[model samples]
Target: MYERTARESMCKFCKYVIKIYGNQYLRKPNLNDIQQLYEVHESKHGFPEMLGSLYCMHWEWFNCPTAWRGQYLRGDHRHPTVALEVVASQDLWIWHVYFGVACSNNNLNVLEQSPLFNDIESGVAPDYSFEIDGVKYKYGYYLVDGIYH
Candidate 1:
């Protein structure tokens, strides 16, 4: 578990998403950082792109400077900011997400409370397929991780 102070510092990541992705975002848990977060979920976090190739791409996008740089030092636009990404695939369906935030359990909590995982609980599984327009559409976290349906 994260200390009160540590969790507070990590909250910047959550706030950034709330400001950008609105109040709707999934929360997982506070993670060490983008790198560590990827290590934890890459196994179950599928990839329609390829094996390790797409996973690498997902990591790159997650820590991409262009996509995520506003959460550092009072949202300063001059310094280098890191990006973050998450990807998952199921059967013939795949999901991809690129955003800025620490991938910690605590951070996930914040995300869980956001609009992303508003209706999901901690133990529920994500849904990978859904019907749309008389056809089945693959669905999952596009830019955030949470219950997939």
Candidate 2:
């Protein structure tokens, strides 16, 4: 009952947020927005055509069901957990987020299962123009650790 109530409240809150700020803050960035982001990112971080930084965080799932306990456990974390992956700009605006992956899955698994990454990889990615070391490229960069394969 508590879980159901909490889930309903959270859904309502999310709907409220989307209704109030979705157009300007929650929606996907357009090509012009991406260009502006790249400019700001470059001037601050010195990385050309950078869209954002990617990171994954794990949240302990104290009430995880018994059947899924093993699926959510990793060797490093004694308890079950859920993983959340996010890409955020320097200003802390979250450009993308994928949540609810079992902690047993690493960043690579999370990314591979992410619909956003699939969409981006399917050619909807922005054509960010930049040159590095005298070589030109058309892809925007998202800074991530070597955890991804």
Q: Which candidate number maximizes lDDT?
A: 2
> Per-prediction TM-score, please?
0.22, 0.77
RMSD in Å for all candidates: 17.0, 5.5
Residue 121 displacement (Å), model 1: 5.7
Assess each prediction's global lDDT (C-alpha) against the native: 0.40, 0.79
lDDT of 1 by residue, 25-69 (tens): 343322223334345445567322122222321122234365544
Query: Where is model 2 more than 4 Å wrong at Cα?
Result: 1-9, 128-131, 134-149
* lDDT value for model 1: 0.40
lDDT string, candidate 2, 77-142, tens digits? 878989888889888998888785777778778888886677767878665556677655444443
Best by TM-score: 2
